[model samples]
Target chain A: MARAQWPLQHGRPIIEIVLTLAQGAQKVTRRLLADTGAGAMHDPFDIVLDEVDCLMCGGKPSKMVPLGGSYSGTHPIYVIPIGIPSLGFRDSLFAVGVAAPPAGFDGIACFRFLNRFTYGNFGNANEFALET
Target chain B: MATATSIQQLNRDLADKLVEEAKLDLPSWPLGKFVGIANGHVIVVSDDLDEIVSQLERAEPDPSRTFVVEPGRDYTKVCEIWRIS
Candidate 1:
């Protein structure tokens, strides 16, 4: 069976986890469009976990914290901070607020997500493959 | 009219434009902020943090406009993009 788990060592620190890929998940990310200071921005991406993927019941939600800012506005936002692992890439442990489901169970992948895998695109096939 | 767009709108427009640019060369996400236009140079911010920052520092940017990126967002919680010559 294909493995859904991976282990990594970051600067002498080792961590591991098992991940499940589902379809129709959405990825929320922040990109610098204008002169925004470094560290000035709060959580750039927030990913919401799907019910199927979310085995936790009572209050085990993708806990979101308020990142004070005028740009963030009055909107109340939350995020589920977790570690993500991919094949052939480094491990990513960032808080991804569960927004919506992804198109595929492959789960929502982001730039940080990119860091967790060996990524490349083939000609017209228009598909991405990853392994861990 | 204010002639200014909302952050959401700006992000959408930027995403579309950058995605198109990526077709030629995979454009980096969030080409920083478009602070103000001046001296014909479009000042860009450096969004990379930690190690990425170091990597970007060692590399050269497009020669035309010298993009200046403050380490992190300013006290305003926004980065300043100053146009260059």
Candidate 2:
């Protein structure tokens, strides 16, 4: 089984996953937040990103949809390869790029990604683990 | 299965190179903008999404293959709060 650990900060399980956005040979990697609850089937995307990250990754805007709260607006979606180096995981999924993301996160890793692994939060150890 | 494996392998290789290059080059890129990468090189950087798409259409027609980077944001902070109902 492959396992990875992450720290719990501010009552949130924060883990570093490498995100690779690519078309052909072009690719970029950045660390992102592993958010277990960020997934919403109603949203039309598997992951969420800051607007800049989505566009930089060459994601085309699909139409503005209401996301509720102050976050409502036009959001862009991109189909790209996302990788979690820690788990040796990689897959292509739809992602939403929003104008504003909450503090300290480049993007959120929702259930679409998290559902792939068996995870455990070891608060005592100040870490979380993911097993495939 | 074989095809999937090959694709996975290709993605891994591309990801490895990207991670390495990002560490070396992205530190100097201006923050709060979308940056596009293709052929292992930075192609365009802009704050306007339309501008990025236009440039990418000419540089990398297949957007899925082009990599985009969002520069300068802390990944450690708690961004979304979750509550199970």
Encode model 1's per-residue lDDT on B9-83: one tens digit a residue. 443344344335544642333333222111222233334222322232244221111112212212123211122
Candidate 2: residue B27 Cα off by (Å): 49
* Candidate 2 lDDT, A1-108, residue by residue in tens: 788776765556655655444345455655456666774433345677776766565464332333543255445456455666767876555576777666666666
Top candidate, metric lDDT: 2
Model no. 1, DockQ: 0.02
Cα error, residue B44 of model 2, in Å, equals: 27
The Cα RMSD across the true interface for model 2 is 11.7
Alpha-carbon shift of residue B34 in model 2 (angstroms): 26
| Whole-model alpha-carbon lDDT for candidate 2 | 0.55
**Which ranges in model 2 have alpha carbons more than 4 Å from their true place?**
A21-31, A41-43, A60-64, A122-125, B1-85
TM-score of each: 0.27, 0.53
